[model samples]
Target: NSKPKDTQQSMCTPVCLGASGMVHVLLREELLLKEHILKTIILGQMLSLFICGTAVTSQYLAEQYQVNTPMFQSFINYSLLLLVYTTMLAFRTGSDSLWQILKQRWWKYIFLGLADVEANYMIVKAYQYTTLTSVQLLDCFGIPVLMALSWFILRARYRLIHFLAVAVCLLGVGTMVGADILAGRQDSEGSDVVIGDVLVLLGASLYAISNVSEEYIVKNLSRVEFLGMVGLFGTIISGLQLAIVEHREIMRIQWNWKIALLFTAFALCMFGLYSFMPVVIKVTSATSVNLGILTADLYSLFFGLFLFFYKFSGLYILSFVIIMVGFILYCSTPTRTAEPTALPQPGSTGLDNAALKLEENDSETPAITVQFTRGEAVVVSTD
Candidate 1:
């Protein structure tokens, strides 16, 4: 009787232990999956914030430069500062490198050159006419326009929540733009700032187009290679403007060491920023990319508030809150698919194999076999 009882107990032990092990493995896996999802989301948020900061800072610097272009030009001490930067970059990089990239990505360089030159010139011109706040407020239109373009042209499927969020942002834009218009009219000088606003709008549209175009460029080139090309092209475009618009002024300009230093700092800031923006987009999602731009707007507004004592009225402040809340509502909605996940074709192993390997016990038991026989037997067991 003791022998029979002992045998029964021994038989139950392995069964009970196996079941417990399976349960433990499943729990661990669930925890890991949850952790991974949380990490991805957090990273997305951080990337968005970082991108925004860079963008805001760049705009602020541009505003500063606009205030004193000739002075800014003098410090750089070139009749054509844009050309100077381009020439410097070209010389620094050497012809061989530039030619190699031109051969591979000529069209992309053209787009970058066009966008950069237009964006820079417009922003500078806008700042000379309208307030920084006005330029930024008008620039808000870019985000919505880009989103619409991405949806319609790029066929980027967005959640309904995203559209609602954008709608909220548009309302904010209307309020701010409306405020700027009223404020402009009340100004004693009464110069036509409308041109400045329109220029900014055009710049905004170009930016949207460039940002989308970059997605393709990144696939073909290294980050360094792409940015170098953009900077080079931007330099050329600016050089032409310097030649055409301010050549005589530039020739008569006297160098100011202090201003030159400031210009250098500003250029460095832009270089760092533009380089990082695309990289951030690559690491994160497009929504995050847009979020970065929005954040930058807030940052720029805050900087304006600090530097210029730019005050926001009750309506503008209210609009800001509503837009942000709408964005939060949209961004917080669960993504059905985060980044695109590649699926294996028929006859190839699927992600299930990878997912299974992530199991803790399976990791420890490297000899475990995943058996999938033709049309019938599918088993995962220790070999």
Candidate 2:
């Protein structure tokens, strides 16, 4: 028993203790961030604004251009998205050789592409069957749904206060949607709000899934590879779909300069927004990222009111406030657990240590001796 304790202590020192020390600091920083009411409020506002604005722009493009093909729209959206992310990666992953960048983990791109592609397609299809406001109502559900998934499936932990905050924010958002629907502001004639909601729900679900998947992927992949692959794959899928579905319409339509400018602007906005989102997530917590984006609703609201002249009932205001509150609550309540770092086992050479040594030496060195607690030792050399 005494010997076992000694061995345990020896193994625990650098591995467990060191790990705990580093993690404790990180956890503290995360907690400190949580305590700051100002940070959460500011971040939430920013995120919401961006989200709203982007939605408005998207809806405007769809309506003005009368683009009917869901797949084609998704393709175009992603093509632009790919370009944006690529440029971001170039700056973020500076000095990484192109070959090396390609070699980096790429599952992230796949996940992003899949989520985005599905979201885009679902949105376009939903719009065909419903109104922009209706589609938005359904789409906004993604935030809460995302929280639930993150909590249960991802096993992310949160405090009670955080949950309460999320509830408030979600309630506000719900109010807004309810208000819109009750005011006879649903999508155009022949478009089913029910179907649109369902489609949007599906799209939201996919988006939520992608968020979780992105966390894991980001841990392994470089930004370049992640976004590059997404752009490349999404472009291919969208292009094929466009070729089959929109070829005739595209050829017949007049290429107005205004339309071209709008499309370019839309593409640029999308690429830039998405490209920056991950960086924001990395710099802060997902909660901050989500809540900060709550302004998206407000942006949409203003767009609907002014740019599109979309009418809303008093109920719309109530619903919007409720949903916004709910979102705030949702974001305020932490759902994701900080990822724990893997530590080397007793008697095992640390991967980090080995890599550092190799980088420094770059030589065929003699065998490095590794000893066990029982006084037994073994030597393994490296090339």
Candidate 3:
């Protein structure tokens, strides 16, 4: 008597009942993970646009309404974010230690806050003395500073390609800055060029330090935890500084709905920017984040076209496109050297031979083979 037909076939073969389904499931998971990465990058870019645009709009409104106290803006922005996150922390469960973590690592956040404040202050203060040309030129030094810190402090490994990518990015930035200078942009605002240039340079360095600290925190702590800590410190530190420095000036400024709305929008964007930064760091790095932000100047130019009717330089447009190319070149390609998972080689062990036989009886999926080539692991898939 013949057995039931379902029982007659070999269960291990490619045509078995469940083999194709298993492969489909595995492939689906891989696809979903790739999709997640794509989504994150897109979201990060959108958030960046919001951050830069809103910040520019806020500054424009401040100038319009004669709001002279910038530090007050920073104080309110940090305070609002702190309150929001603190509320969130209250509702969330199973979070990392709030106060305890701060006690352990408070200095880092405090320093980050100070660096953030000082960088903004220095750049704003620089405008009182330096030409816009010098400020724009010196600001780019952050990239090199960040990369150096990443290499030395974070122990990041880099290759020649990485250096080339950074060079292309910086070259693109230099082109844009040079175009502004050659275009004979009006500088009716600067007073002491040398002192302001030095301040801008120092500000760029402080910005790099803050960015590195951000990357470090993102790598160690959860996004919520880090944001809460930063907001708490930023509000306290900036509030105290603002009170001492701008107490009289803030009282003189006109408080109106337009100013209030602009301030609210600015605060929201700051919150969004800080919140999304950790996700970007998780997806890529501080270097890539800086690269993405290199486009902010381009966005500012576009916004200026609408508001200020500034003459659009074809050279500036070309430089921006070049920067985009460099950013895409740096990001779209996987920079990490692939660590080939070493598969069992032929004749390495008796079980490896048995495994090959079993593989043949199984699905048509290729067998993974590993070989060492030039001290690097190379993996080959053989059917």
- TM-score of every candidate relative to the true structure: 0.60, 0.67, 0.75
**Candidate 1 lDDT, tens digit per residue, 22-82?**
9999999877766644554455445445544444444444455433453233223222333
lDDT, residue 20, candidate 3: 85
Which lDDT tens digits does candidate 3 get at residues 1-383? 35555455544554664778888999998787667556645665666686676657655875687666667777876787688775565556553556566667778778888898888778777877988777877888888899888877666666676677778878888888777767676465577788998999999999899878888777876777667777888888888898899999878867788877787877777767777778888778888778777777767777777776767788888887787677666665444423334554554423332232224445766676555444444555555
Q: In candidate 2, what are the lDDT values of residues 1-383, reduced to their tens digit?
A: 99999999998888988889999999998788576545656655665655565566666656787644446545666777567666565555444543445566455455567676777677667767767666655676776777677676556677777767666765566666666666566546545767877888998788777665554445445555555667776897678767877788677656688767766665655666656566555555555466556557656776788788877567656655665555555554445464544533445544323211222243555544443433333345444
Clashing pairs in 3: none
Q: How close to the true structure is residue 350 of candidate 3, measured as C-alpha lDDT?
A: 32
- lDDT value for model 2: 0.62
Superposed on all Cα atoms, the candidates' RMSDs to the truth, in angstroms, are: 9.0, 10.7, 9.4
Q: What is the C-alpha local distance difference test score of each model?
A: 0.57, 0.62, 0.73
- Per-residue lDDT, model 1, residue 97, is 59
* Candidate 1 residue 365 C-alpha distance from true site, Å: 24
Q: How many angstroms is residue 332 displaced in model 1 relative to the true structure, after the best TM-score fit?
A: 3.0
Candidate 3 lowest-lDDT run of ten: 349-358
Off by over 4 Å in 2: 1-37, 62-65, 69-77, 80-108, 130-134, 148-155, 188-197, 219-222, 291-294, 312-383
